[model samples]
Target: MQKQSKKGFTLVEIMIVVVIIGLLAAMAIPAFQKVRAASQKSAITNNLRQLASAADQYFLEYGIETITSAKLADADVGYLKAFKAVATESYPTDIESGTDIEATDVPTAVSADNTLTIDF
Candidate 1:
C-alpha cells in the first residue's frame, strides 16, 4: 500500500503565513499613518493660506485693519466662509488647525509682507 500526503496546508505552514501577514500589516499601518499625517499638514497649511487671503481681500475691500479671526468665518464676505475656520479641535481659539502654525505669520503676511508662508 502507498502512503498518502495531506491535501491541505500543515499547521506550521499556516502559522508562517499568519505571521507574515501580521508583519506586513504592522509595517503597512505605520506607513498609512505617516501619509495621513502629511496630508493633514498640507490641508492645515492650505487653510491658513485661504484664511490669510480672505483677510487680505476683506481689508482691501473695506479698508479694515483689525480684522478678527471670527470675521474669517463670516459666510457673507469671508474667505473661509465655506470652510468655517472657527471649529478648532484642540484649542478654544478661532482654530486649532492641528498644526504648529505661527500666529504672527498670518497677519504679517496679510498686511505687511503680503507674502503667504506655510510655517510648518
Candidate 2:
C-alpha cells in the first residue's frame, strides 16, 4: 500500500493567512482615510482659488470693487465659465476686491473648522 499526503493547507496555515490579511488592512485603512481627506481638502482649496481669480477678473473688467457670487457665476456674462461647489461648502455672496473670500459650512472631512478662507 502507498501512503498519501494532504494536498491542501493546514488549518493553522489558513489562520495565519487570515491574520496577516487583517494586519495589512489595519495598517492600510487609516492611511487611506488620511489620503482621502487630503485630496478633498486639495479640491476645496482649488475651488476657492478659482473663485478668487474670477472675482479678480470681474473687478478688473467692470472697474468695481464688489461683486456678488451670483453675478460672477452668471451663465451668460460671468467671469468664470462655470462655478461648481466641490463639497457642501457655502461660498460668500458678496466679495470685495483685496479682501479674503470665505467659504462656510465646509465639509468636516476637508476642514476642522468647517470653514475655508482664500486670500487673493
Candidate 3:
C-alpha cells in the first residue's frame, strides 16, 4: 500500500498565517492614520498660505488688513477669490471660516486688534 500526502494546509500553518496578517494590519493601521492626519495638516497649511497671499493682495489693492468676516466678503473677493474658490471646491467638507477654520488643527495668528498675521 502507498502512503498519501495531505493536499490542504495544516491547521497550525493556517493559524500562523492569520496571526501574521493580523499583526501586519495592527502595525499598519496606526501608521496609515498618522499619514492621513499629516496630509490633512499639509492641505490646511497650503490653504492658509493661499488665504494669506490673497489677504495681502487685497490689502495692497484695497488697503484692508483683514477679511471683514470669517466669510470672504464681496470686497475681499478681488484679492483671494481665485484661490478661495479653488480651496472651497477641493475641501468641501472641511471648508469653514473663523472659529471653524481654527478647529481644524490649523494654527492661526490673527491679532485681537484686527491685524491678520501670516503664519504657517
Q: State which candidate has the highest TM-score.
A: 2
Candidate 2 collision pairs: none
Ranking under lDDT, best-scoring first?
2, 1, 3
Give the runs in model 2 whose Cα sits over 4 Å from its true position. 1-3
RMSD of each: 8.8, 2.1, 8.2
Stretches of candidate 3 off by over 4 Å are 1-3, 66-120
How high is each candidate's TM-score?
A: 0.62, 0.81, 0.58
Q: What are the lDDT scores of the predictions, listed in order? A: 0.54, 0.85, 0.49
Query: Candidate 1 lDDT, tens digit per residue, 1-120?
Result: 999986999899999999999999999998996676556445545666666666667667777564655666767654665453222321113433333333332232132442234432
TM-score, cand. 2 vs. native: 0.81
lDDT of 2 by residue, 1-120 (tens): 999986999999999999999999999999998888888778878877988999898888889999887887788875776656776888888989999888898888778899988887
After the best TM-score superposition of candidate 2, give how far the Cα of residue 75 lies from its true spot, in angstroms.
2.7
Which scores better on lDDT, 1 or 3?
1
Better model by TM-score, 1 or 3? 1
Report the number of the highest-lDDT candidate: 2
Clashes of each: 0, 0, 0
Error of 2 at 87 (Å): 3.1
